[model samples]
Target: MSNTIDREKRLHNRTSFLSNIARQLGRTQPLTQVERPALRHTCQNEVMATFSQDQLKDELVRYTETSLGAKAVVTTKADLEATLKQLCLDYCKDQQGNAAAGETIVSATAALLEMVSPQSLETDEHKVHVWDAAAGFDANIKIAERAKVGIVLAEEALAESGTMVLYSQANQGRAVSLLPEASIFVVAKSNLKPRLTQATALLHQKASQGERIPSCVNFISGPSSTADIELIKVVGVHGPVFATYVVIDDM
Candidate 1:
């Protein structure tokens, strides 16, 4: 009874004192951090449900219809190996100054060597790879020697629509996303999810556990493209003319 009364009075007194100080200071934030329990309360945000496969497909389709071109799904290791070879022979052959897509992956660089030009683009031992999804990709790929295209890994790519998600990190530099004209991505079957909302939620969950989200969170649909010039649809004016997404099954 009395205790409750005292607590109420104390809170009231505190509020009054702070309010007075605030008035005197004329916006007291620049000098000292003021008390605002109300502001802190707003920090708690509502977590939304992530997208399902169907939703992801829709997003992909929207992107493809506008820019991103054809996509392929690879289920086995053999498929990956074959695709790597195909990209080297096909994408690099005729392209002299063309910038293709960057290949994206979590790890494993067995076929990466083949994708990079066989020319002496490497100084010391670093091979000149046009685009590398693996972290710390410093080697310059000799596109001039073969073909110029970039490949990046999709954190999550929607199957129905063909959209790719690129979560930038220190290892995965911003250059991989920007410098290349074309982009190639490898989305493993294991990581494929349904929606963008869900994927953002997953990223949020990681951030909550004291993890830092990459500097860039890109949702690329297809090639470097722009319809901004005089409202005419121009491809490769802004980015690659062709961006391919290869869906692979985990082994």
Candidate 2:
């Protein structure tokens, strides 16, 4: 009993000393209760809340073209490959304003490889370099920085904002969608949501299912642009100058 008392005394003395040191350093005991600010109520727009799927898609396409200055194309799954190929050829022009021969194209969407073969894009003079993001980290970075065009797959698209969601992972790095001169997204018609709220709910559901969530989720509305300099809007300031969405209906 005496030995136990001694140990308790020593422990108490040490704790007291530590507490004093903490106090000298301007640290105090933690508060039992912390005051938390109340969350502000958010107002929901009725039009976005009640929009039909078809209406939402139309709005998405319209906004993408007019407001965001992004090209949006609707095509059947069968025609996706051909349409995408043509778009690439048209967008990836050379310095002389002609269709370049040796332009590099990077793709985060693995499914696109089979749709538009890399070999098909390559020519004797151009030597088109098509890289799959899944290749490796080094390769992804190299391709992203140098590629004239980058293609990715959209997990979800918000019709109200004309934004497409891209979750970054090993197979889909953020650079593949951001670092290129032109960015293209392949979105399925069924993946289109009316508003950001719906998309957020879906993301929350996925999180609740113990699924692997990516480190970054990008909501790309259009090409990277800003009006900060002299209030003159400039596109491709921070990322791709051009953005395109290819919505596959049959997919």
Candidate 3:
């Protein structure tokens, strides 16, 4: 009898709470549909808008190098493969003192995978273990956890903030970029934008065109870092400790 009474009291309280909320909202029935206004920007920076494509790219490189503390390199399509290999050899290393043999994770972007050329990554002297992001989520997570380097392709790069916009998709999992010790993003010159606003606008336009928007969009300005503990400034606390951007000039 007591248990039944307690349950009834709880239900009464919940109904009363909901009734009070509805009363305050001045509506007897829940709203079924609501209209939202379009987004508008009243204040626009003319200077940023007026910059040429070359100027925007230059600013992006400068800010990426100085402000973000990430290596930014400009290469042509022909030299991209060689440049990527050199970067891996420079950064990825193993206990045997061989970088080419280091464990690496590469995103499954068609362009990126084509450039990766796993065969070229392995030489007679050293054979790097390269895993693709297309592997299942759990497998990719494990690979990323132990991988020395992670490679991804950026959809858009914002110059004003030196930010790379990464859309999480099947081919490019978020873990591939976040779980590794170091990350390298390949960005095409045509995808570089003058500001974050422009980049976001483009994404909205894509969505409006009925393109499937990614589950998540990550805007990475630099390597993961924090100064929370005694303000000592630690890097790679929650994500990649080192971030590098390779900008393809002729892409």
Q: Which of the predicted structures, 1 or 2, would earn the higher TM-score when compared with the native? A: 2
**Per-residue error (Å), model 2, residue 215:** 1.8
Q: Per-model C-alpha lDDT, please? A: 0.52, 0.75, 0.77
TM-scores for candidates 1 onward, in order:
0.56, 0.75, 0.77
Ranking by TM-score: 3, 2, 1
Candidate 2: how many backbone clashes?
Answer: 2
Tens digits of lDDT, candidate 3, 1-251:
55546555655566667777888989688534345576485354444787776777899999988977788889988888788777777776665766445666777778777766756755554344445545556876887788777888999888888899998877888877888788888898888887777877777777556555687899998899888889877777888888888899987
For 1-251, candidate 1 gives per-residue lDDT tens digits of 55546555645566667767877988555345445356545222322125554444444545555545554545455566556545533444434745343332222233433433324332232223433444234453333123344555567864434567777654455555455544567666556655465577789777556455677788766666666769976666765556666655542
Best candidate, lDDT-wise? Answer: 3
Candidate 2 achieves a global lDDT of: 0.75
Q: Write the per-residue lDDT of candidate 2 for residues 110-140, one digit (tens) a residue.
A: 7666566656655454344555544767876
| Shift of residue 228 alpha carbon in model 1, Å | 2.8
> Which whole-number lDDT from 0 to 100 does residue 44 have in model 1?
23
